[model samples]
Each structure stands twice: as structure tokens, then as C-alpha cells.
Target: MREPADLLITDCSLMTPEFDILDNQYVAIRDTLIIAIGKAEEIKDKYEPKEVLEGRGKLLMPGLVDAHTHTCQQFLRGRTLGEYPMIWSRILVPFESSLSEEDTYLGAQVSCLEMLKSGTTSFAESGGVHMHKVAEATIESGLRGAITCSTMDTGPFIPESMLASSPGEAASRIEELYRAYNGAGEGRLRIWFALRQVMTSTPALITLMADKAREYNAGLHVHLAEHRDEVSYCLQNYQKRPAEVFDQFGALGPNMLAAHNVVLSDGEIALMKERGVKVVHCPRSNFGSHGFPKTPTLMQQGLSIGMGSDGAAGSSLSLFDEMRVFRSGLHAFWGLPIFDPVVIPAHELIRMATSGGAQALQIEDQIGTIEIGKKADLILIDINQPHISPTHRMIPTIVESVNGSDVRDSIINGEVVMKDRQVLTMDEEKILYESGRALPRVAVRAGI
Candidate 1:
């Protein structure tokens, strides 16, 4: 007598938003939202499902969200290792400035496939060129993404081709991108405005883009105070820290999504909290040599924080690795300094990858939890493997032992994008082949 459900996973171990582990549960998906979650007997009696998955040995949880990434940098992987500080100005800019439109699309394909295989269903792109191509690649890959174009009006390392003639032109281009791709891919895609970094951005461009983002209800993405160079640059130019400079430009607000943030004063942290700004921590990307982020401080202040892989160029597009690296780094930096053994709990790490990331992207209402009416973005980790076989503690085991290879299935927007480690939406072999053929050209162009 009841309508048919789209898909159902029966007899699974579910991790709730509150980090509670529930067993012998069934989750029903109808269209893009989760329609039912309860005991299997009641769910089976209530609705007929078109397809059912056996989840006996799997842990079904909300999909991981990558809060910051550079899809266009996949082609430059391994090029920045052991390099000097400020690789963005020395190597990253030249590499990105030389990439063709096709190259950008290929890069996105590589990054999206990696993310999907690693259990990330959604990501927020930091900034890049040919974002339309990036969006097209993301839509084809069946992943949710917040796409943005790298906008710059002034400052050094300004590639002649990348620098905008005027701040107005840069803002106009961002607006065009938003209008074209804001809700593309059946609302799985969002368009945000970006400033590449403080050193490369002007006050006029910052204010204009912020206004446009507020107008469109989109978020503003930027790399803020990632290292001492950025902080020193802001101080020399604007006589304030990076966050204060952004605030003076009328750019810091609830809609701002700041990445890195490794070098912030107490005042800057307080200012961010007061303005309700969201923060993304890329531990592997920023904490290698420059400095560590004030994540514990940010967490203590109740600021919404998320995790990111940065990209494959220097780091990787895997939240699993990010979690391990973040946990280990936090233990050494903040934990040892204060002599506290538990700086960040394992469950909190998982929450940052899921619900906290969703909050940062302003999509918490639609995704990030295994609740009714939320989007069916979820992943299944096969715990039947050897490493995780004797899993006594679910959260700690997932944090310390689980790798990206353990993700067996991925579902986004009510569709199975990957099943049994095989991706349904992308041609893995074809992408690798094309990347092999194309990497040489990109490398030669980039002079790497």
C-alpha cells in the first residue's frame, strides 16, 4: 500500500550525527533525500524498495566533505616537494597560469576520481581557472562541489594572462560563473567567489566580490594567513594582519570560508569568531614547514571548522589521510605543548569531515547527517578487511587504521557513484591514459 523507495541498505551499523553507533538498522532513500531510517522490520513493512544492499559487515555513515581543494593542481603533483617556502608564487602560479582549458578539465577529472574513491562526496574548490570545465567534470563525476574561479586584480607573480585588466572585470567574471553554474548538476553544485590570496588581491576586488557573494547568497573563499609571508605582506601593505586587512575591505563575514589560517593573532581569531566566519584546516598543506594552525583555539571558541586535502599537487585529495595527519599533528603541537593527551578526539575528527564540513559550506541543512529529509550522501566502509577486522572501538579504529582503500561504496544525491571499489560515473583507465599523455606537455610548459 506504500510507495516504493529508491534504495535501501538493510542490517547495517550506522553512525549517527551525535557519534552514537547503532546496529541492525536500515536506511531508505527516496530520490535525493533519506526517507526512512529505523529497524529493518518496520522499514520493510512501510515501503517497498527497488534495490537493497547487504550492509552486515559495513559501517554506513555520512559522506566525507572536503572543505578546500584545488582541482586544477592535480597535474602538478609531486612538483613542489622539498621546494622553498611560498611555492604559490614561485611554482604554483606558473604551473596554473600555463594550463590550457583542456588541462583544467583533465585535472578536475583526476582529483574528482581520487576524491570519490577516497569516500569524499562533496568538496569546496579553493579557486582555479576554467571553472566551467571543472564544474562540467564534477557534474559528470556525480560529486557535489562548490566551484569558484581564481580572481585577482593586482600584486606580484601576476601572470600577464591571469591578471585582470581591472577589479570590475574580475568581479564581473565571477558573477558570470555564479549565474551559469550556481545550482548546476541538479543542485549538487554551488558557485562561490574567491580571492586567490591577500597578496594577490586588491581592496576593490575584495569588496566587490564580497558584495556579489552576499547578493547571490554564495560563500566567499580565500586563503588567509597561511604562512608568515602572507601575514608580513598584509602588515607591510595594510598595516594589519591578514584577517584585519580582509575585514577592512569589508570581506570578513559569515559567508567567508577561509582556508589555512595558520598565522593569526588572538585579535584576528576573535574577529573571525565575532563575524561568524567559517574556517578550513589543511594540516598537510600548511603545517609542513611554515607553522601550525590555531585549530584548538578555534575549536574552543566554537567556530565552525572543517578539514580539507588541499589537492594532489603537494598533499593528496583524501580526507582519510587528512584525518590521520591532523590527529598526529595536533597531538604533537597542541597536545604536547599543554601536556594534554587528547587534544582532539577521534569522533570530533569524523564530525569535522562530515557535519562540520557541511556547516562550513552552508549545506548542513541538506547534507552531513544520516537523518530523514537530508540528502542521501553516504559511504560504506568495508570492515571485513584484515586491518580493521578486530575493530573494538569504531571511531578510533576509523581514525587510526582506516585508509581510503577501505571505502567500498559511495552514494551522492541518491545515486550510487561507486560500488565495490569501482566508480560508475568515470572512466578510470581513460583518465589515467589521458593524464599520462598530457602531463609531459604540462610539465614542459610549467618548466618543472
Candidate 2:
């Protein structure tokens, strides 16, 4: 008989939902599942594992999850930092037109490396074209990702590949991608349909994409109401707001994942909550945009809120950066004394980046928390740094002090994809080199 996964991580501080700190604990893993989590002495006594890993002076928490991203945009980092929405659209569309399959793969690889090192084990991606390259990179990186190929039908700004000739073609391509990669990578990779932007997609295409997503029981990912111009365009063209138009097309549901809902009315927020549609709050992207509305009001109204880095162009694909931006934005929006500024408590921020995001993606039961029977997806943070000293409150210290360099080990599906800050699946040096080579080409095509 097999040894039954004989792996044990002992003598660590475990952060369970029930307890703030469970010191000197052990987590047992078998195959791809977490078999046990309890006191170190008790677990060591119960099952004698073939291999034991020491976790002394480390903190073990659920792996971070990014609810929204554009993995293929990593090459565009620092290029679109100060541009407006229209300028961004102009730059992005033309740049995307020049991306080859190799460029997409390289970009995804670079982004995945940044994510893994930063303690994100899973993420949902919204990329322009080259969905296959994105999927391949995610699989090779040993990270769980929900990949969506951007789809559009009628937009003066979008590229040709994103827009199919007709709604039927759009639906067909989405179904083909879903059938090919939805359950691939041993369930580590999922496929979803992405409407590139609210104004970019037609009403008929939106409804058809939603129907296709429902048929496959997959999530519909889209960018909605990120800027005032987008909302105004929708209002001018459709005589309704972006969210209302989505509602009219039957696109707001539990299976929908909307990004950057920064300009929503009270009714629109309520409608989103009522329909169980999840929103991803990308503070860094909003700050970069310079005109995003307040999101704390929507958060307070009991809407499912998750965190995302947006993309390299706006947020740099770093969850730590996103958390810092979220903290600052919350403090600015909700003043001190009465509100405390720390609207998202440290523990809650971690949860938002992990379980909250999984819930938004409807994958909570599989890989969110560090519970038994869940996937063994977790990160070990080296809390021995000077900034993390006086560790009176571990969670808060981690959220406020720690950076991506503090992540010592990253495990997903009982597999160690990164150890001691070294990525195991892909070559980081090569990715950097390829990205450097591809950026000039992208910039030229984008007319920057």
C-alpha cells in the first residue's frame, strides 16, 4: 500500500477561522487534500508520517487569492500609469493587436511568478487574446487560475480578435474554450467568458454570453462601471446605467464576477446584492483611474466584496500592493475615531484576499480556507523580519508590515510550487528576459 502522503508541517502558528492563533500546530496532507490540522503533539502521536517539515517561527495561513487580473498585461506595467480611460483603451487595443502567442505565454509566466512569490496561489484572469497561452502558463506554474478570453462584438476601440463576426460566433468560441479548459489541469485551471468592457459589448452579445455561461455552469467575468466615462457612455447609448443594462440582459447573478464597480448607485448596489453578483474591489486600479467612486458604501451594504490587483498596467499584479492601497483608501474614505479608518481589519483583509475571493469565484468549498478536506493550498510567511517584530498581533502585523519577500513557501494542491522564495515550475530569469524583449514591440504598436 502507498504511504498515504506522509507529509507533516509541525511547530507552526496556524491561523484558523475559529482561533486567532493556534501555536505549535501540525497540518497533515494526503494526496491533494489536507487530512489533518491540530496541535503538533497530538497529530504527531496519531499518525507517524514518513516526512516531517519543521515550521518553527513561521506563520501558516490560507493561500491568498486574487479575484481579478489580466495576466497577459504584465508586459504593459508602468506604461499606462498616468493615462486616462480613453488613452488606456487606445494604448491597450493596439498593443494587444501585436501580441503573439509567445508574448502572451511570457507575460502570463511573469505574472504568475510575481503572484506565487507574493503568496497568491490562485487568481481569476481576464486577458485579451491568447487564452491558450494563459492556460498553459497557469498549468505550468502550478497555480490555480480561472482564465477568460476577452469577448466583444461592437466597439470602435476594441481589437478584431476580441469581437467575433456575430453573437453566434462569440458564443461558439466561448463554449469551445470552456469545453477545452474548464476542468483541465487536474481542476487547477477553470475557463470563464469575459466581456471586455461594458460599452464594448453589444446587448445581444452580452445576453448570449450569459446564456452560454449558464449552460456551462461557469462564471461570467467582466469589467463594469470602472470609470465615469463608461457609465456615461452606457447612459447615453442605452438610456440606462451600466449595471441596469446588465440587469436587463439577465447578466447579474451569483455566477457573475464583475470588476471595478466604482460608480454604482444605491439601487444598483442593492440589485447586485439581491442577484448575488460578486464585486472585485481593485483599489490600486481605482486610484490610478483618479475618478472612481467610493466603494465602502457598497461594502457596508452586505455585498460580496473581494480584492484584486487589476493588472500590471494599473496595479502591478501584486496582492500586497493592492492591500496597501485598500488600507490607505479605506482610511481616507472613513475618517478616524468613529470609523477607525481600518475598515477592513487585517484578518478580514486576508480573508477577503483568500476565502472571500474563493466565495466570489464559487470555489470556496474547494480551496479557500485551511480546513481539513480542503485543498492543501497555503503559504508560509517568514515573520522573523525586523518590521514584523513585537508580534503582539500576528494577523495585523502580517497585513500591515509583511511584503511579498516574506513569503517563504507556497503550496497548492499538496504540492510545493515555491520554496524559500524560489519558484519551481517556471524560470523567472527567462521570463524577465522575454518580457524585456517584448515590451519595446508592444510599445511601438501602442504608439507610445
Candidate 3:
């Protein structure tokens, strides 16, 4: 007889990268990896599964990946929703700086639950002083993340808690963080180096970080060319564009993910393509910021681009919402009589949320897709609702019709983190209750 699978999912309508639906399919997981997948009838007889999940009336897809987000900011979700200057200077800075380790842990607990409920299995956290606390929460929540330690040494009015004081101090701290948590949580959690941004980071700081990332074959995440003021500062001080400074410092590479690349020049885009630098687009977050990255143009130029929510402040932890917003967002903004309004198809949006994000994190071969020999990171979305009726056509319905709340179950690393919208690893009710209580304390500590 064939080997027994640790878990089995059958009768699922599998969503493919080509946007086709494979109805009545089955997937088998052994340990933490996908061992087999095929037609439901065929696979059912092939393996003896310890546990079986009837995936009837559901859609199975590779779990979503948020290529750029701040778990640290989940604590201040609705507390700050004003304009840019105040959003950054008065709110974001103080709020982040004021987080105690416990407060940060609470943020991670709730945010990870939010993502699982919304169908995100993996995410790239953009580093914060309290990021290790986020790491602890991920370990407890069974979320896969490329998390980081926030290393900011300089910037105007930066809070003292996040300041590293010098390049050496920042480098040492990064090394310590990496050694402690780089491959923690049974290889589900990764520790990447975060530079914060160009305005605050010195060349030495990022250069050292680049070397360290390369040495370990890890990815680096940072904001690049997001704001107009950032670009102006780079030109004034670095004698080049913001992207150019990154290029010169050896920070622009395949493993580097630059978030909110809103102001890329043609040459910079070409340079990014040449360097294999990846990008993360935060559509909701960009509404009041500079502008959305020229995604259509970037896609044409052959750059690997992914989608991000930027956490609760920038957007919700829902890549489902990001997908709809991003697809419509692209056309409604600049395609008026200039080009086809439907330039980006729903299929492309799905790719950006999955395989493209995998390439961005330099883990394309591992967890992004639901293929045999890949880690078992997947979610099941319930489509037995009125909103997603007319099941004859599933792709567009999944893309445009379905929302994050439709995600009914989630499995990560061969573990069912959630079942029927109930999170299995963490205490969902307690996390929600504590998040509300911590918000006021965080704000009070920040004196905002």
C-alpha cells in the first residue's frame, strides 16, 4: 500500500497559476510539505491519511503573501488615519517608539490572526524594534514570516528607542537578532535586515546589512523612493536618485525587496530590472502618499513585483482586499483614454499576491505555490455564499467577488492554523480582547 499522509484535503476546486479551476481535486501533506496532489478520486485511493478534510464547496489556492508590512503598527490600527505629515511625524513615529515588548507581542498576535482569517499564510514584516516579539507571536500563531529587526540610526526627530546610535551598533544588533531568530519556528520564521529608509539610513549601515544578508542568503526589506520628499533628499545629499543610492550601496539585488516604489524613473526601473531588485505595491497605503508605483509600466519592464497591505495603518492585513483594490486601482487612476482600462487581468493580481511575492522574498522554490515537494501553505475560501454565486465562472468571482472574510480555513507548514474560521494555534478571543486594551496604553505611552 502507498504511504499514509499526515493530512488530506479532497473535493477542492484548486486554483492554478494559469487561472483555471481544477474541480474535485485532492492534496496530501506529509509532515510540513505537500507530498501529492491529483484528482480527488485518484488520490483518495492512493494514500491513507491520518486526518481528512472535506474541501467541498471551497476554493484552494496557495496562501497569500504580504511582501511588505509592519506588524508593529497593528497596535495603532484606527488610532491614526489622518493626512501624511501628521500620520508620519506625530503618529507613526511615536506609536512605534512607545511599544513595549508586550504591546508588540499583542499586535503580532492579533495581526497574525487577522491574516490567517483573511487567507494570508506568509508575510514579510518590515522590521521594528519590537519585531522579535512579533517573531514570538508568529511561532505561537504558526504564521510564516520573513520578519526583521528595525535598524534606524539617523533621521530628523527619530524616537530614541529605535535609534542605533552608529553603524557598528546597528550591524551588531542585526547580527544578534539574526543569530537568535533567523531560522526560528522550525524554519517558518526568518529574520531579515531592515534599513527603515534612505532618509534615515547611512551608507555604512545599509552596506554592512547588505553584506550580512548576502552571507546568510537572506532577504532585505526597506522603503525606497516612496515619498517625494525622500527623492528630493536623496538628490540633494546623495547626488543621485533614491534608487541610485541603493544601487551604489550594493543594496539593490535579487534578495532585496523595496516597498512603495512610487517614484521610479525609467532609468531607475531599468536599473532595478538589471539588478533583479523586487518591489512591493501598497495600493491602499499609497492613496494619501505620493502615488501607486507604475505597475503596468513596471510589469512591461520585466520586474518582479508583489502586493502588500503595509499593515493596519496602510491597509488591512487582507491581500484579498489588496487584490481588488490594486486591479481596479491601476485602471481608474491613469488609464483614462490613454490605454486599455483593463490592462491588468485578475490572473496577474493573483500572481502578484502569490508566486511574485515568493520571488520577491527569494523563496520561490519553497512555500508560495501549492505543488508537490513544496511546503504545505494553503487556505480554503468558502464560496457557498450569495456574493460568489454563479459558480460556473470561478476566477473572476474569486478575484472580484470574494473578500477576505470568505477564507474559512488555513493550513501552514502542514498544520491547520485555522479551521472553519476559528484559529487553532492562538487564542483568538483573548488576542482580540487584549489588542483593544493595549491600544490605549500604547497611545498613552507615546503621549499622542
> Which ranges in model 2 have alpha carbons more than 4 Å from their true place?
1-3, 48-51, 290-293, 336-339
Candidate 1 or 3, higher lDDT?
1
lDDT of 1 by residue, 54-145 (tens): 78899999999999999999998888889987688888877888989999999999999999999999999988788889999999999999
lDDT of all the models against the reference? Answer: 0.89, 0.81, 0.85
Quote model 1's TM-score.
0.98
How would you encode candidate 2's per-residue C-alpha lDDT over 53-147 as one tens digit per residue? Answer: 66887888888889998877788887786675675578766677677888888888888999998999999887577888888889899999888
lDDT for model 2 comes to 0.81
Candidate 3 regions exceeding 4 Å error are: none
Top model number, lDDT: 1
Q: What would the per-residue lDDT of candidate 3 be over residues 275-378, giving only the tens digit for each residue? A: 89998888888765677678888989989989889889766889888888877778777665577866787788889999888887788898777789998999
Colliding residue pairs in candidate 3: none
Which of the predicted structures, 1 or 2, would earn the higher TM-score when compared with the native? 1
On TM-score, the candidate that comes out on top is 1
